[model samples]
Target: MPLKKLTYLLLTCLFASLLTGAPAYGQRTKKTRAQLENEKKRNLEKIAETKKALENAQAQKEVTVGNIKAIKEQISSQEEQINLMEQDIDLIDMEMQDIVSAKEGLETKLQQLQKEYAAMLYSASKNSGKLNKLSFLFSASSFNELFMRYKYLQQYTENRKAQVIQMNKVAALLRERQSNLEGKRSDKKRILSAKVVETKNLEDLKTRQTAMVGELSKKETDLRTEIEASKRSVTRLDNLIANIVAREISRKNKERERLQDQEAKIAKNRPTKQPAKKSENLDGAETALGRSFGASRARLPWPVQRGFISDRFGVKEHPVLHGVLINNNGIDIQTPSNATVRAVYDGTVKDISEIPGLGKVVTIQHGEYFTVYANINQVFASVGQKIAAKETIGTAGVSSGATEINFQIWHNTERLNPESWLVPR
Candidate 1:
């Protein structure tokens, strides 16, 4: 209501607003930092896993495709780690700058409060004498004026106390900001140090990859033979999966036709035309399951607990052979020997078969979708058995010169890229 009180109220509101708004930026920055750190941790774990796979492959005492793949994967993860470190450093720098700016603003506010308090103290000293205070009240023209003078003195005293409290709070906040800045600097230093180690590791991996590729190039003749054998195994597995999938599709089609005929007979028996409920169709569950699985695109868990993709879907040039291409229907995941394989989604085991060089295979039907896990050493799922997501299905087998499994996702007849469906490593 009074000028001084109104001014004080406005200042308090402004300060409160600033305090409330500040955390939004800080929270967002903190979230970004956390995300980067988490990604970096995952990347480091991937590098460690790839290193173990490489060590196993190297035990053969000669360069192999598996060894080369492991080296490349390690290098990729190492590079990504370094990149994350750089991003972390940048974030730290930015946050430090913000802290500096905030500290400066707080210091300015503290100084302003001190100046105002000093002025109040100076004015208060001039009226320190009891006679002066009484003279001022007595000099009022009326009782109302005198009462107003008394209230003014009380408000002035309260404002001075409030100013002191504000100054103390601002000073404390400044100290906190300075400490945070120091912590950020330390974080940046640590990331920079880790970056150095990661960069060195990356270089080492690159050297190993180059040497392995060179060595394998010299054995191109044997490489071709290996490729031929792998191709035959792939071809045979493709045929088997195709046949199984076709039979399943045909069976579902016949059932759908039978349902359609039954629905027509019921409709004919009705007195009036009635619409067939879509939910009653056999494809209802399939549609719902397909939608659920599709919604989980890029979020499905890996078939194995720990592994890196050694070979991707579609066709790629052979690592050692010139002008030669290798075609893959599914992505190959390289894992530790006897790694337990699991279903990526809820499905029913539709078939279990074995190829000569590819070992055993398990095919699971998820509504209209089918997932094929080949190169399995053992199968834990039987045909017609219901499987839940992440349920252990089998153990990985050594195939194509590596302990890995070929993972494929199919939409009835069309093959989908398994990596696209899988979560990023």
Candidate 2:
């Protein structure tokens, strides 16, 4: 092939090779942007919910433990929002850097193309004075040489035109990249402004929380009494669920024994198998239901439509009382007054009872797993009724000057953290 054709082919292959590496990088950046946006959306939603809950608590005109908890949650979400903004700024910076680098590369390419085109023009002009195009071709020794000369001139002119077009394209692309870089910078500036506002809001929430805690600390004696009453309520609910679950296990065991006896009478001479394990002896349907419920870990819907956990599971020191620890059997969700409570998963209503200081309670059983919803004001489902996921069971009742509910999950007699079971907000 001619030198000009070979050079064109080599340049085309080089451009193609450069283009082939773009999609994977683009896909990765797209995924990162999507994830960041999703996280920010979730953070904002939590902030909104916490704001509503705080508004409801403030409307009561009394600073209670629930109010302080809501403020703390608000502060947490606000800080998270600010962090997300920082992440956005960081991502934009990275994008701008890439654009700057690409713009520089395009500028360099355009310069090279212009330089080459100028050199080609100078060479053609110098040769033009020596022999005009028609004379140059006709002066060849034979018709074949003349034809070859004509083809060379044609390719040489085309190469210069191609260089000029390429330079124009690179310049246009550089302009577009500059525009994109400016856009990213503008985005970073906007997010930084929002972040400043969020930081201020977070500081305000923390100040309010400190004031509430200081006020609560003044009522240490009353707070202690209330804490004791709440513990009693938790103990009562725990016993209720334990007794009910025990009875359920006994019933299943009796039914299994009855079947075994009937089988024994039918096949007297048959060899007896070893006693089945406790889990194996349980009803097959119950076992399957337990498996399904277990499989749904971290995917179950919230019992209430909107709320944040005011109190987490396990034992922790009280926020106001010095050296005082509160043992929580379940997570406490702070929601709006009379907010409807729904079942997190499909189960049968095992028990519903009212206890002192805790309002009404409803317990649902999913095979060996049991979920208890307490602090309910009104119960809608009856005992032994089958309930589906997100089915309304009752409405939350007010406590601690704010509306809230205690939600728990248990496997047989062992308590499981509701936070681990429920999906992230």
Candidate 3:
């Protein structure tokens, strides 16, 4: 009966450790929430921007109706974000459920551990009585036998005490797990609310995109010099983002190295056991790249103030060449004959130069993100200079094939669709 109880005790411990061994996920989930919230905040900012852009988009009253399949992509992206958020909420729900279930089971586990500990202690105490003690030395007939029996009894006593201590420790752990479980349940509730909010916002985005398509369908689009100018701006922005992200990667590597060393040292004190598999590493280089680009989203400001979007974002039939379609990463905001372009956000100026066909351009780096305001007649900012939000950086000029301000967003050399970010005008 005692052996059966001990086997059950060992099995219970093994099961509990397996269930609880995952490194704390709460902090990682919090970071994910922060990133997603940042994305949502940026997305909402885009809503305000698109509203503003839609107001000015009215300038080009002419609209040409054709296939509008591209707007579907924007809608899809928004839906995807919403879907991902929903999945996150679902995962949180499951995790919390497990924690809660574990907690509910903990009271029984604690009672069992305590009872087993007491039983072990009581059994050891019984063996410690003088009558039992006498058997250790007296049961042996030879001197050598006596010493061996005594040593065996001493080891047996220590083993029993150790079992009691281990059981007591496990009981305390069960209580701690119970507290953590309750806290996780509360957190899951909040995430559920956030998921609902994101879902509604996604549906709203689709309606707005539909409206944009309807308004733009009347105009015949043209992309002459605009192509070259937009390309130059995008390249510059890409360079800036790459540089900034590279620096960030370097910094993160240093930090990881420091922490890993500490983890290695701490590992020595921990008992050998199977550790839980970690979820996706959001801190990895690939994930960071996504963050650097997609994370920038809609917080960025417009380059030209008081301009009509003479051209919308995406692929269009070349204005002059009817058979040819030109792919555009962004839109053209046509201002008065001479409009001074400004920095969209606080950042370090990375480039200030003129390209042959693109005219003047200025690029700025903001942490791991970058922005370019190009197709300028005059450049005012210098490389390596720190610039603030809305600071006048240059004067608009003819670049690529259009006389309009060309803007682009980049993160670590990857170009993100500025159409998703910039105010739609």
Candidate 4:
């Protein structure tokens, strides 16, 4: 029986250890509540931004295809917000479960401690008479036995005191765990309420998106006509860009030849036989500027502070028109009306012109590389003027009844995707 009791004790201790160890391990691996809350806050900010963009898009009197796109984007943001809220609710639920487990563990420990404390008190009560304790110590068989009895009494006294202290400690801990569990329950309730509201909002946004898409789908003919006009505008812009690039190239070549001829004349007047090195296509300042611009690839700032890419570069099927492809030389960013447009990098304003269908456009040169900002309502910088990165160069112009900017990056005559160059929105 003694052996069986010893085995049972060992098993009980092992079970308790595993129970306590599991939560400890989980606590080490799990994200804290603060971390989850911070992520949720950021997600809320993104939702707010998308809502603002949607409001701006709606402000336009005419309901164009862009308005539908804006609504779709707003719906996407609402869905993401709902997802984040769900994640937050899940985290709260996990926290509540953990709190419940902790409360249970504390209750178990407190019960065991109370039982041990009661047992100690009962044993002490049975030997409450001081005379009995003294006589029991004195009735030892030998001096050594008497000393052992005294030591045993002393140990017993200490054990009783320690048990009482441990009981109190466990009771306090159990109370703390109970309070924490209540708090967690309350938090779970609040999060669940929030989740319900967010889910409803998401559903409403989805319905609105469906309606917008449906309305736009009925105007396929008008959308197709708009697409055709946009295609023509893009073609005209491309032709103008090409002409500008050719002109710049021609002027650079002429400058290079002039420099080379001057160098040749100077070399002829020199008394040395060393040939002059070929003149560089760009001047020293321009070459340095180019190096700086090239080094900043994929790190350049957005042309507008607040916007989203409405159209991406390369070939894409028209959003509203079926069986139609639109080739985009640059990305189209949708922003608030009259949003300030800024330079992506430091450069000189090569030219500023108004294309018939493209609106006001400003082109800046960074050596061989050029960045063009189109669909500008107003130009702040002029031709041949030096501009710094993030400097306000113009205001975004309205297009298709929505504020939009067409941004392009070019290396000499070769057009590159502006999205690849600009920082992620």
Candidate 5:
């Protein structure tokens, strides 16, 4: 073959490989339509839940700081949903751009393939007549030349047929690309419409939040009085928990002494000098309960499945009262009205009592550790009744027009931060 023809063939092969071997660089990292839709669904669910909580908070005729706070939280959740929708819109836009670019590339490739096919057809037409083709073959100078002419004619016809096939393949690919681009453009339009609706909803929530805050701000004196009442309730709860812990410790100590006396009597009757193992004489059930509860720290289920911590454990500046510090031994979880309060762990109810400011309270004992659930309307578990983990103990009571439960954990006499022990919300 001529050097020029050999070089041309090599270049064509290289170009074909370049077109076929192109990497899909951004395909793996890009989020699919299903993934984006799933995220939007989750955000919508969250907004709905927040709305329900707000409705429950506003059920009472009188408005309180808790109600205002719930409205503010709902506003926050709506804002998050809007942000997520914005993200979805942005992703759709990016995907649309990519589709447009890919379609343009495919169109350009199709045009090139059509031009190549047309050129081949024009060359074939120029040598159209069979008489002209026969004369050209007869004009060869030698037998070898004639054979080369025949082979070249055969190869040329095959090349023209291959070019036509290539053109059809490119046309099909171009059509597919166009279809995909249109679909993406449609998706972008829908996403933009959804975003507009979400944006309007977000604005409405903000307006409501502002109104709630303004209403609460005008009642500063009433808010201060409520805070004082809450402080008194917290104090009474602390005292009650302390007394309960003391009584429980004393009871456990007496039981330990009795067990020791019984072991001693058995040992005295034994004929062997070897001492009995502690595990053989001690109550395994009592010891195991404490160990199991302790082992479940940071893994314990929430007392209420759906709620937010309105008041966290430890001392902090009051939300409404300036210069006032409120100390919390346990977290205050605010939930929808009539929400069922469940036990965090398996235990026996130790006491059921009512304090001056707070409502009904239930204390459960898991060996050495104790759990307290307060601000409840009705109790389902009585004193000395065995309770299972996540079993409903009572219905949450409304306080200041909002349902809030005070949850606490104690190991013997030491009070623990319930937030640290409970699973993250």
Candidate 6:
């Protein structure tokens, strides 16, 4: 029973080894890493947005320990499978060594058997020519001795024939097994290399997952605190702006009263012809302002100092995820996130307001031209304020997420596409 179990175990190991060897061998069959790499790199920029989102998500709390555990489990499973494949290959190698030894032994025996067969065939031919085989049986002294001699000759011929046939069969089987073992050798090597790479990738993924979970644990608390602080700041800013607007309106009323008194004196003293010329000039000024509203593309100025348009103004499909369309009123510039958001041209500040969905937006008016810079994190100028070209009017507001500056070009009420102005990336 012990012998039986041992034999069974040996057979089971052999069978299992064979099953494992195939997959190890199979892994080296095909790959396209360069294609995969080219695809991945030509594409990291697109995921810049996703990375930004993940960065924001990191600051939040409520990281599920379960998800982290699951990732670890998956990594463990892959490692276990790799290990099994390695063990199976090792067993197969041992089996191959045994087969190799058997093959060598069989080869030696085959050579010896062939030599014996060759000698027998030669003897048979010589005896046929000289009649030694016939003479041996006929010259026997007794019938029993002659019968015994005949039986010995017959058995010798039969044994030689059987050995030649057996040698050929064994040689064939050995060659076939050797060829299979050679294949297994290459297969085992390939599988080992693959497992090493996969193991590294798994380790990297696990590390990232663990780090993400850790970050998430702190991020939630931080986000809540940030949100509350932002609300209070927003409220305070609103009240301050209201007071500023009231003061400005009062100042404008007083200035208008002073201008009216000067105008009344000038009306009594100036010539009638001067008033006619003044009226015509006023009409022309109004017409010029109206014509400048949403003027030709050539009149527009670039927004940022040193950047190209990464994305254009208009409706277009997303670069990474196909079939998804994005509507953009203005172009997106590719530059460092920390870069300053400056005025595109000389303009007067029109309205600075916190737009719920759009963040803080600052509207500036240049003659009759209007520009809107949205998603502002900080503002340096206020309403009814004068700003020069390239002035640092506001700083971009980032949500600890993707830092994007939403900009708009408007002429009074007419909106112009920013794409027409900015150079394409």
Please list the C-alpha lDDT of all candidates, in the order they appear: 0.83, 0.84, 0.60, 0.76, 0.75, 0.57
Tell me the tens digit of each residue's lDDT in model 2 across 143-183. 99998999898988887777776667667777777788788
* lDDT order of candidates, top first: 2, 1, 4, 5, 3, 6
**Highest TM-score scorer:** 1
> Worst ten-residue run, lDDT, model 3?
62-71
Clash pairs (backbone) in predicted model 5: none
Put down candidate 5 lDDT per residue, 1-425, tens digits, no spaces: 85334534743673475356322423642556567667667656556656776776566655576776566656666676667767766776776666566667666766776676576667678777445677878899999999988877777766666666666665666676667668867876886788788788778877876676677668888777877887898888888888988987787788788988888888888779776755353556877999999999899998987787666789887655558787878887788668999999999998999975578999999988999999888889899999999999999997766788889998987889998898744
Query: For each candidate, what TM-score against the reference?
Result: 0.91, 0.89, 0.44, 0.67, 0.65, 0.35
Between prediction 1 and prediction 3, the one with superior lDDT is 1
> Residues 198-317, candidate 3, lDDT per residue (tens digit)?
678668767755665556434424333444564565565445446655776686688777667667766666668946333333356534544654554675567777554444667776
For every model shown, the clashing-pair count is 0, 0, 16, 0, 0, 5
Q: Judged by lDDT, which candidate is best?
A: 2
lDDT of 4 at 334: 85
- Model 6, 147-230: lDDT tens digits are 987987776666565656565665676577678778868877886888788688668766877675565455555545644564
Runs in model 6 deviating more than 4 A are 1-63, 122-130, 219-425
Instruction: Between candidates 1 and 5, name the one with more favorable lDDT.
Output: 1
lDDT of 4: 0.76
Compared to the true structure, candidate 1 yields what TM-score?
Answer: 0.91
Residue-level lDDT tens digits of model 4 in 312-380? 789977666667888889988888777999999999998898886689989999978899899999999
The TM-score, computed over Cα atoms with residue i paired to residue i, of candidate 2 is 0.89
Candidate 1 Cα outliers beyond 4 Å, as residue runs: 1-3, 58-60, 129-131, 138-141, 264-283
lDDT of 6: 0.57
Q: For model 3, how many clashes?
A: 16
